[model samples]
Target: MSTFKQGRYSRYLKPFSYLVDLSIINGAIFFFEINITNTYLFSLYISALWIIISFKNDFYEVQRYTKIVQVMTLILRQIGFFALILYTFIGVFKQPNISRLALGEYLLLVFLLVAFFKFFIFYLLNRYRAAFGGNLRNVVVIGDTEKSRQLINLFKKRLDFGYKFRKQFIIENDDFSLQKCFSYIAENKIDEIYASIAELSNKQINKLIDFADNNLKELKFIPDNKDIYAKKLKYEYYEYIPIISLRDIPLQVPINKFLKRLFDILLSLAVIVFLLSWLTPLLAILIRLESKGPIFFKQTRNGFNYSEFDCYKFRSMTPNKDAHLNQATKGDQRITILGKFIRKTSIDELPQFFNVLFGDMSVVGPRPHMVRHTNLYAEKVDKFMVRHFVKPGITGLAQVSGFRGEVETDKDIINRVKYDIFYIENWSLLLDIKITVQTFINAVKGDDKAY
Candidate 1:
């Protein structure tokens, strides 16, 4: 069995940042040659004051998901406090003879150096995580819901954020017990636990809090509707209907949407030009030899906004009346030998590049379902409709994560919705490229679930 490795040194990063920030502060005093009567005494006062101000402002409490803009705001706030203290020191000690120009230069110099240091370290850490996959936190979600699953998805999609997802434990299930979850956390060395506030009882929540505190694990809660404003949930007004959001979705931003669309258009056009341009005709001839049907299979699948669109694929099954109603099962008699080959290699899905090009789909998103299946799952699944928030895709996170093909049971469909929701909640350009590359590798390796 594999063991979960937690990030042991992250606890030290905060103090290390403090040390560097203080050094930059005192070092600037001499570097800028600020004139003062007793430089050492003033340095001591400023250093102590800096620490107090930083604590009051929560300046050093940077989290993994803290944005660059937030850090800039922190820097500005810290500098303002520092300026106030400098003037106060002059007033208290009666040193008006000090060179005002020199003090101004000193303040300006410290601000520049500190801002550069903070930003440089921030950028470097992100790059290191992205390139080398280090500094990771082993996290587990304690409840299964839209908000918990959204956080789990964020952890998976944002590699640079440095969270390694372990598992999600459903509290609503009959077999679930706090003892089992506690044992898993201990054995797996989990670093964090995220529980949904709506799912846990008061007693269970208290137990979890005690367990996390005893084990030195971070505990966070997923806010419910009632606790949205109280818990600082993102609030937006949608035509007078107040809405609360759990996280900031990148695809919801205008620029991110444009960039993803541009990427889909370029990549779809390239595939249609280079691979599908020749392969489509050859597959057409072979498909004709095996069965008497249209060269391309077209069916209505749910697209963005619950809209129906004709999704195209190379015909892989024999002509049948149940084609639109039934999904292809393993060892189904309707599939031809060529169908099996094409489906395993994912050649049958190549024509959907045209769907992507036509703007009915994206290069990566939730895979659309047949119209009947969509209507059924929308009723049966918890967050199935959330998949319709973004354009459907030929291949998706679910497919690449081994949730593709025939649904053998309710668990299969449920897991598919989990990953689909995760993809929608945490869409990123890097994630799309990663899923696409993984899809190709799975195609070449032949997925057992492909049929």
Candidate 2:
């Protein structure tokens, strides 16, 4: 029996969305009677621009498992950008005779209508999938981990998501292998494969990827949160169980990168001019008086793409041979009397603003580790290098969230990498500002791990 059901309608969703959106846009134009010098040309241009904007912002690319919040975000982004493009078109052509109020009303109408239709379709589809069992995907899970079991349960429970639980392959015994899994997939007509990455070897994983691609089946992993994969992966939520795919990083976008770098430059310049310029001299005098070494300490640290850079910091400890190899612990003997004050206040990290200005680091990102520690942790910790996807920061989500200073245990670094990867994958200007504010508050209040 072909269990595919009426899911073939999934293919028509994009086209239907396109037709309805175009109708709503043109219908509003006629209803509003917005004045344009040439009605036909203006209509054509705006309609085409709307399509391009939709594609650009993934407006019509709603997936079965996508959340309503994500749908709202997509609508808002698409409409906001489309509005800007529309106004820019008016200004460029000097369409001063066009009624501004009429255009405003038109845009408001378009947003409301488009959002209504989108939510309506989303809700209707959910009801259809749950009540009528339409648009369901037959899936097989390949592991018995807690996460994988949770996902299987989700497939059986969340009827709206439309994943039909087929079978789970447990690889715990000697009888199970990739060959058997592949045979099962082929026999059962599995539309998607969910694998627990911890249960498979690197070679086995490669074969599974090849098989999935060759068979035209969607493959997703139920990852062990403690381990990191080097491959580019994206995360989606199946009502809270995270699904990983080829990651889409916001910072990788050109505009986002430009904004972050611009913010870094402006903030670093301000700190250098107003604070570090005077504070450095006072600190320099006090450090020279208390210790014999230089005021600034430079160490090689890993940055984006595993590139080595000289990370700068105010000297917090007296000269020691173990500086590069060892991390500063809670009450280290090498920390000078002045070092204690500066370290606790995080003033020692001020010289890093120079690194930020020099473009070696960011104001907010994964905190850089010494070259030696980087090498050690890359081997000891899973996904430790995932943080290297973005430039290292003087302050990061990990640091502010209580994972700063010394690495006392393996679990400590594991949690830190988890937070670092989260920040990198979900970077935003607003998130950066929030983290910066939280960092300031933590500094003022003092951190137990600051030492």
Candidate 3:
């Protein structure tokens, strides 16, 4: 009974959404004297736009378990974008016959009607199910890892989905008793079972299938081999056998990342040609006059995907300063007088524009750690390697958030990693710009920790 209910509700959502869209279009056409041709074009454009944008925003993601406010916001955003595009088209083509006032009123009416309809329908369905106690799907998970815990937490947080989580059954051996688990499932009225495919053997998988078949329940298995951290999965049919493969890196998703890289490359090139070219010469003269050593200090650092690269910085320490990968301390004797000034102003990091041009790093990302320090801290910090998931940067969230100085303790590195991970998870062009602005302010202020 639960299986039938789940399948029916799942299948109904798509057709329901289409009907709502059609109803909105009909309402708009009735209210305004829109040309049939323009109406059809506008409807088609909006339909496609909503579908594409919603998919990108994960609006239809079942796991997201969206709220009414969230759905309303998405609907408003879609309508706004659609109106902007429609107005732009009218203006650019000089379509005088189109009534702009009518169009605006129709857009508002359609948006409000459609959003309210969708929200009301979902709300009523939820209330009806709750009234009858009919919508809850009992689920059992098969693992206890962080991933499994995450799944459990999502279900718990999203109660509107009406999922009642059953106990997580730990599978110990290939020959575990399926009969006992099946009996328990029947008694508990389990609607579905989710298992980590990597943790279960062939025999256990078969047992799960048999249990599902007997109880008429659904079974879903999570793949274990894939790096779940990377958002790249494609479903394809090969000889009628469906296979899922990692699509592409999320950073290479669309014009967004490409445009970002282009911006980085052009900006880095400009800085190198106009700013660094003159500045490097002046800094070289100052360094040579003050001390007797090279103009740049090249050190090996971990780049994207844990790759080793030589990071270039204006020499800020005296000759033969490499002692033990030791970070600079306050009043360090090895730092030259000019080096102190350059370090304080963060001008010493200007040489990294060359590194950016060489594709060793990005303008904004997790700041790269020295190779030796990376090795040392990987053992000390939890999930430290996650920082390598993206290219290292010259300036990062950590730097802007006051974690940019010498990491003298485990806590400093831990906080730095926390901020870096946060940046990676919530990256955007706006965020990059914000970090860059903050970094500039910090640079100008010459905070004591900058040294």
Q: What digit string (tens of lDDT, one per residue) describes model 2 on residues 1-451?
A: 1121122447678779899998988788876756788877777877888877775776776888898899999999988987897787688777888787888899999999999999999999999999999888889999999999999988888899888898889989778888888887778877888999888898988877756533445688888883476655667778778777654668876457767988999999999999998999999999999989999988888887667899888998999889888889977999999999889989999999999999889999999998888777776766676677689998999998889998889989999999998998899998998998898898898899888
User: What is the C-alpha lDDT profile of model 3 across 338-387, one tens digit per residue?
Assistant: 99999999999999988988888889989888778887776677657667
Score every model by TM-score.
Answer: 0.50, 0.52, 0.51
Cα lDDT of model 1 by residue, 1-451, tens digit: 1122234546577778889988988888876655688989898999898887886677876656778888899999999999999988888999988777888998998999999988988888888777788887788888888767777777787787787899889988999999999889889878777777779998998877656533445677676565435655555331222334444556866456767988999999999999998998898899999889899999989787667899999999998999999999989999999999999898999889999999999989989989899778766766566677679998899999889999889999999989987887788899999999999899899999988
- Scanning candidate 1 in windows of ten residues, the lowest lDDT window is 236-245
Report per-prediction Cα RMSD to one decimal: 19.1, 14.5, 16.3
The candidate, 2 or 3, that scores higher on TM-score is: 2
lDDT: worst 10-residue window of model 2: 1-10
User: Which sequence of candidate numbers ranks them by lDDT, best first?
Assistant: 2, 1, 3
lDDT of 1: 0.81
A best-first ranking of the candidates according to their TM-score comes to: 2, 3, 1
Clashing residue pairs in all predictions, respectively, total 0, 4, 0
Clashing pairs in 1: none
Candidate 1 regions off by >4 Å?
A: 1-232, 236-248
Task: Report model 1's TM-score to 2 decimal places.
Answer: 0.50
